[model samples]
Each structure stands twice: as structure tokens, then as C-alpha cells.
Target: MTVRTGDELPPLRIPITRTLIVAGALASRDYQDVHHDAEAAKEKGSPDIFMNILTTNGLVGRYITDHFGPRARLRKVAIRLGAPNYPGDEMVLTGQVTAVAEGTVEVAVTGRNGIGHHVTGKVTAELPTDGPGTGDAPGTGDAPGTGDAPGTGDGPGTGDARKRTTDSPATTDAPMTTPDTPR
Candidate 1:
């Protein structure tokens, strides 16, 4: 689909729960105590466990990509967190297209929770100019023959590994020695 500046993306509403906060933190590999431990968060000056920045980043990316369709690739995502997204709260995400050029779309986004803004940021994404629903874009998830064998060159893999070679100094005659292993 053709996009222009001032286009508003559909708003997304998400409920914040303990499971959501913890699951999102884990999914993003953020193990900070404040993101999972309510008591620990309280001790650290927060009312309870809160969502992590990585989770917010992922959500923001999801919001933009979902609106732009599968062909969209996030070039950059910059967000700042405000109010804590604690359990029992809800977050509403909204975005607007700030600029559109060649193959890129710039979006300004805000995720607000019950207390206040949870995240505010800008996202830059590349969209296929051919229009949406064409499914010919590189990452549109509708590529042909993608369901083939994992190592098949017909898919997304490099044709054949036999054509490539490593530049390591160690030859076939020598035992591999890494930083943890002595010669």
C-alpha cells in the first residue's frame, strides 16, 4: 500500500499483567530483578515489578511492522520510557507516519499506560513500494519455495557449503586450538 506523511496507524491495546511483564522480560533476555520480582522492585523504589526496556522496544517494533505489513524492515527504533508498566495496567500504542521517502517510512509512536506515557519514540522502516499484499518483498513471509528442506539452496540458504572455505591458519593436519585450549 502507498503510505504518505501524516498517516495514522491503527492503535493497539495491550493489557499489562504479571505474566506479560515477566514473559516479555524473559523473551527479551532481560533478567533484571526489577522486571520480575515485585518485592525486589519495591526495594529498588518502584511500586512493583515493571516491564523492561527491551520488551518495550519489541512492542514498538511489532506495532510498526504490523502496520506496515511483513515487507517492512525496521531500520531504527529509538524509545524512551516514562511511567512504569506495572501489572494490572494497560498500554495503548499509537503511531503516525512522520515522513515517507523512496522506500522508507518514518514513524512517531507513543505507548501510554494508566499512569502516563510508557514509551515514546520514532521508528524508521523500509516498505515495499510495489504496494502491500503483493507478497514479493524479501521478508514478506510469502516467498515461494520457502517450505523446502532446511539446507536446500532453493530456499534461503547459501547454494552449497562446499564452495566456501574458512581463512583459519590451522590446516587439516593440525588440531583446532581455541583461546580456551592450549596448543
Candidate 2:
């Protein structure tokens, strides 16, 4: 596909349900009580259970792939959490293409909820030169929360979060860098 810097992706609104919060925590294997136990969260100073970083990271990846299509391979994803995503809120994800080079595209993303910005980050993806939807259907590839290569829950109390392919283990130990960094 022909993408350009400054292109904006359509915003995606996601309801923040208790089920979603608990399920995401469970799926990511982030047994952190603050993510699934309201009482525990309150005990820990949180008003209620909150969305974990792994879930937020996955959502950010989904936002990028949803715009660029399934052929888009996520090269790098870096994000930071802001406000907590509690049930009964909604998070609207939006992204802007920050840079495009050769067959790769970079986007700056934000997910906002009633409290404030829930997540802010950047995603780098390699899109197929053949255009959108040119490969396997979405959800057919490595999905977040699954024991897959990419989304292996690198959050608190989890394993490594480095990028990898389904067929092989990750080979890099370097830190996750922005698109400006040399690959």
C-alpha cells in the first residue's frame, strides 16, 4: 500500500468491560492481582482492577495492524501506560503515520479513556508492497496473549517481551528503539 507520513488511521473505540480486563490479564498470564482482583487492587491502592501493560501493548499492535491490514508485520512496539483502564470506561485508539520508508511504516499511537490517556506509544511495521489484505486474514497470525512469539507477556511478573516469529525464537537482546534508530 502507498502510505505517507501524516496519514491518520481511523479511530477505534473499545469498551472497557470487567470481563475484558480479567480476560486480558488471564490470557497474558499476568497474575498481577491489580489486573483481575478488584479487592486486591483496592488493597494495593488502586480503586479497582486495571488493565495491564501487556494487554495495552497488544491493543496498540492491533490498532496498527487493523489499519495497515494483516500483511503488516509488527517490527517494534514501544508503549507507556498513563491512566488506568477500569471497567465502565471506553478507550479510543488513534494513530498517525509518523514516517514511511521503503516497505515499512511507523505510527505514533494513543489510547484515551475517560480518565485520560491510557496508553501512548509508537509502532513500526513492515507492510507488504503488494497492498493491504494481501496476506493471511487478520487473527490467523500470531495473536496477542497467546503463547506466541511476539506477545509473550513481558509485563510485570511475566517473561520476555522481545519480538519473534512463530517459527523461531527471538535473536536480539538490544533494547526496543524508535524508528529513528538504525536497525
Candidate 3:
């Protein structure tokens, strides 16, 4: 879908669990005990294990990119944490497009749990102008005197210019095993 200013992104709901908290912490390389050990978290004045900031940042990134598709590259993401995301709670992510520039979109996002806002941030992403759903046809947004046009294959502003195939060997093979899988 083409993104526009004031457009609301689809909400993402995630159930916070012990496994999710620990796994996200591990994935983000944050080994803080408060993120993985409930007893240690209690000692630190938390009711239970809380999510790490890195995980919250990652989730914010995921929310924006997932809304904008794979061609959208994040230019910047600034976030601040509020209420803690504890296990057994649900995090609901929501966002809205604040601005749409020539090749970029700015979004304001918030992730909230039952208690209150868990994370609030603004994300700036560069979107591919020639890709599907970008709403920019060739020769439209290009600078003058560039001689760029659709179907001409002159510059990089051509849409649907390349042939895409889904017949890769990886698609036919079994899923690759990960380190967590048993032999």
C-alpha cells in the first residue's frame, strides 16, 4: 500500500512471556540479569524480569519496516522507554505517518503494555521510489534534465523493470536447521 501522511499503520499485538523476554534479550546481546532472571529482577525492585532497551528498539524497528515493506530502509529511530514490559503482559504497537517527503517517510510510533506506554519513538525511513506501492511513476519524481523515464531502462527510476522469480532452490528445500534444533 502506498503510504501517506496521517496514515495509520496496522497494529501489532505481541504477548509478553518469560521465553519472549529472555529470547529478545539474548537476541539483542543484552545479558542484564533483570531481563532474564526474575529473582534478580525482584532484587532490583522490579516485580519480575523486564525487557531490555535493545529489544524495545528492535521491536520498534520491526514495526516500522513491517509496515513499509522490505524496500524501506530505516534512516533513524529514536525511542524512549516508559513503563516496563513484564512477562504475561501484551504489547500493542501502533504508528502513524507524520510526513511523506520525496523519498522518505517519517513515522511516530508507540508500543504500549497494560500498564502504560512501553516505548515511544519516531522513525525516518527511506523508501524505494520505483518499487511497487510507492506511487511514484518513472520520470515523475526525477530531477529535470535527467532523461529518466519508465520503460526506457535509462536510470534507476523504472518500476517493474526487472524480472522477479520465486523458483529458487531454497524455496524447494527443507528449512535450514538452527543451533536450537536437536540433531
C-alpha lDDT values of all predictions: 0.73, 0.74, 0.72
For candidate 2, write residues 41-86 as lDDT tens digits.
Answer: 9998999999999888888988887777654678778788999999
Model 2 stretches with alpha carbons more than 4 Å out: 131-183
Model 2, C-alpha of 158: deviation from truth (Å):
21
Off by over 4 Å in 3: 131-183
- Candidates 1 and 3 compared: the better one by lDDT is 1
Candidate 3 per-residue lDDT, tens place, 1-183, comes to 455678889899989999989999999888999999989999989999998988888888888767665445566788999999999999999999777765567789999999999999888776665523332233333343333333455334453323321112121112222222345
- lDDT of predicted model 2: 0.74
lDDT of 1 by residue, 32-114 (tens): 99999989999989999999988889889889867766545666788999998999999999999776655566789999989
lDDT, candidate 1, equals 0.73
Each candidate: how many clashes?
2, 0, 0
By lDDT rank, best first, the candidates go 2, 1, 3
